[model samples]
Target: MDLFSLKGKRALVTGGTHGLGMAMAEGLAVAGAELIITGTTPTKMDDALSYYKRKGFKAYGYLFDVTNEKVAKENISKITKEIGEIHILVNNAGIIKRELAITMPVEDFRRVIEVDLVGPFIMSQLVAKQMIDRKEGKIINICSMMSELGRNSVSAYAAAKGGLKMLTQNLATEWAKYNIQVNGIGPGYFATSQTEPIRVDGHPFNEFIINRTPAARWGNPEDLAGAAVFLASKASDFVNGQVIYVDGGILATIGKPSNED
Candidate 1:
């Protein structure tokens, strides 16, 4: 049997217009899943759709904010009606606010939580309802290194992701009876367009990441494809409530001394 095949599966990936989300969505598509990507703007959605079409892959794009519960529900319902039941759901929509806790405004913290934590909850609940009825589904939450570790100036992001880790477990426990699997992917620093400036040679942050990570390099967006495909496919039928850290073993070891051999 082709355990990793996603043929006939329909996957809904939120915030899939670009970056890591797009990479994971492409992985599923290559594995034979029908792709439905979501963005918050029509132009972004159209552009993503066009890109996929140009690649000879048929994809659907929707403009919906996952944090808006009403809009999420409405759009999800519309998607189901227009396309079909979503067999896989990737909660990839999130935001980060890089402000120290000491001076960070209360509103910024709330906004980060709303987008990173609350948004996935809303999306999961709505999609899980359909999957529950069908007796099977897969939900992949886009968690982060912050989900387990803390860094400076990202208090809000860390808190939200930490919460999301537990949420993933809780959903898995509650939905396991219905044959649904809920998991998370904690990605490390990747060499993406968004991090282009910081990834240049001699950049402090870039040097720090290289030294801190056991792999001594930044991750590529495509590096996450295998994990995404495994968690989204039947190969993970028994794996639930797990957070796969695709962080180049950063979470596995402490760190080498700067002067160590």
Candidate 2:
């Protein structure tokens, strides 16, 4: 139980303002880690901070574009200076542009890669430097189901996430000796605002997801908290370079035919 306590630790979560990122960050906070939230949107930052305050967790917010190496470096340095050393970092900030591969603009593809893949690399490298010096840290990359499976109209996203999966392994291989554990969390179709309209009963996508998953349901955001906390805590000190798929058993089996059940 003590292995899971994050007291005396500071966590920096990129894109901690909303969605799955916010969910994981809140989990760490609940485990006793002070949060350093980073986002590009002021409104979201404000709202998130207010929510966290209401929940009685210590948290700070920063604004930055994670894809910008210089800006990320600056913000990391500033946060280290202002908040204290960041003992944990969650590379959760990302963007996805869904479009047919044949027609997807190169620039759009590049942007998705930049945000989803390159951004994690930059953030991890910057944070890992300090973690290396301290000889201890935790880094979590928010990966996706697309890291292993492909879907229509998401070529860029799949590419970025796939690359991110590999990045997680490579980073873990390099940094494990330094006592910094790097891992990833791959989430499945979830009941989020972005998916609300598509999640209603009888919606084609919703129906597909319910049937596709072995657990017969879309994942709840809360489903991710336990995994996030485990990977961020000392409980996982010996665990590195793995991507825990918190996907309602979606990745574990071949799907039953839609007509069978």
- List ranges where model 2 is wrong by over 4 Å: none
Clash number for every model? 0, 0
Candidate 2 on 7-80: residue-level lDDT in tens? 99999999999998889989999999999999999999999999999999999999999999999999999999
Clashing pairs in 2: none
TM-scores for the candidates: 0.98, 0.98
Candidate 1: where is the Cα deviation over 4 Å? none
lDDT of 1: 0.94
Over 1-261, each residue of candidate 1 has an lDDT whose tens digit, in order, gives 389999999999999999999999988988989999999878878888888788777699889889999999999999999999999999999889888899999999999999999999999999999999999999999999999999999999999999999999999999999999999999999999889999999999998899999999999999999999999999999999999999999999898988875
RMSD of candidates 1 onward, in order? 0.9, 0.8
